[model samples]
Target: MKSNKKFYMVREDMLPNSIVKTAMVKEMLAGGEADSINEAVDRLQMARSTYYKYKDGVFPFFNAENMNIINISLLLRNVSGVLSSVLNCIANLQGNVLTINQNLPLHGVAYVTLSMSMEDILVPVDDILDKLQDIDGVINVELIGKS
Candidate 1:
């Protein structure tokens, strides 16, 4: 328990060079360009000391925490700007809309299907879904898949 008393943290600005090197190392590893850390450090013009400073904690953009991608379905009140409201909700959630499909409005309702990235969302799915369900002009909202 005593060992847990000490916590380690790295400030973002303190290791500027090392942070950049860490990204370079990860890119090299992904492209099958470097098999060894020494090679990666040399190829990216990074020092072994910099690599050691941030190696374990740094990762490239491609390795972001996209644990899962999910699909969503929204019921919009078939009216002008109604779809826009749904889109605004997605933006508020920081969701990246990959695809969207809207069918012809039938019975005053339009069904929509959206594929979005939830990796950087600002809120949990249930909360977003609930808020969407409560939005004006949004008749219904449901996550079709893991979204």
Candidate 2:
């Protein structure tokens, strides 16, 4: 049977608060931050009905565990050792770097794209992005694609 369901990648800020809250409630439950559905909804000030309505449809992209390969784009200051630091961060998280494409520095900034295997990643993909952003000289980090 063919499924007609469609998926889209949307920025969180552009989505309705209900959908976002629904995802949050689900995470709270999964992470044991909320013991029950009622508690989860109440903690977020969301109605039980709203939670049920969107629960099956809303999911965080980074939570897709079956995805094995992820491509990320980074903007970094054109300085020595910045790119190396980013690679080290990924390695430390158990992600295997598969490919890297870096552009020449333009106006003191460089754009780099990396494809990595997530098969052995020890942390959530979102956490990897957060760590990359925290690295010195990294101007921006964005998840470009995943497979």
Candidate 3:
């Protein structure tokens, strides 16, 4: 199956009343301003059905920009200096590391997942992957999210 969905960024002032109200309701819920959906809807004077219909579909523009966050999973040989080498390579490329989670080495290999921002990276995603793959102890480097 193919996805035909498309997204656009528009000014808040240009949005319809329902969409704006839905956003307010979402904020109320997230900020604990309202105890429940019913309370939020009542406080915002918006129908509960309307809030549900658009809550999942609408997000602040800043969040859309955060789509640049990339998740990379690596399989590295369980040996000294292997992980350090990977970090150095990423640092050289100017990618900003956000979060890293790694599993204990087992059976001569360790699984590592890293979330980083590519906004300031000097090289393209493919180039970074190529360099990572070329590392001596890096058995695999897989891009796990949108690049």
Candidate 4:
């Protein structure tokens, strides 16, 4: 059987304190702010069990070091130059497009899926999405996956 896991993008302030603290602890350990898990948890006054429980589950969306590739789905008005404009926007943001798939327009709307490398992107992913959404004839932009 396949695992039925799902992911969501949530505001930091809305997360429970334990989950937030676990992320902080991981950051501390990775950044050398704390020498070990024990030290990191102690510094944060968080329980070791709590850290272990959430360590693998919580991650910051804008962590450039860990997030290298991302896939996005877009809805576009079936007008000339719309797709070109979208690609230009991604290139302007320094995102390397790895793959692109566009379905035939149906009812004046086109669906496009793009897989791109975020390694060279200077701006945050959210900013990239915002810029894409701002383009004329672009109906919507959604970040569907990341790795």
Better lDDT candidate (1, 4): 4
Best by lDDT: 2
TM-score of each candidate structure, all chains considered together: 0.54, 0.55, 0.59, 0.55
Q: How many residue pairs clash in each candidate?
A: 1, 0, 0, 0
- At residue 106, what lDDT does model 3 achieve? 95
Predicted structure 2: lDDT: 0.92
TM-score, prediction 1 = 0.54
Q: Per-residue lDDT tens digits of candidate 2, residues 55-119?
A: 98898886645458999999999999999999999989988898899999999999999999987
Best by TM-score: 3
Two-way TM-score contest, 1 vs 2, winner = 2
lDDT tens digits, residue span 53-143, model 4: 9988888775655548999999999999999999999998888898899999999999999989987777888999999999999999999
* Candidate 4 least-lDDT 10 residues: 59-68
TM-score winner, 1 or 4:
4
How should the candidates be ordered by lDDT, best one leading? 2, 4, 3, 1
TM-score of model number 2: 0.55
lDDT of each: 0.78, 0.92, 0.87, 0.90
lDDT of 1 at 136: 86
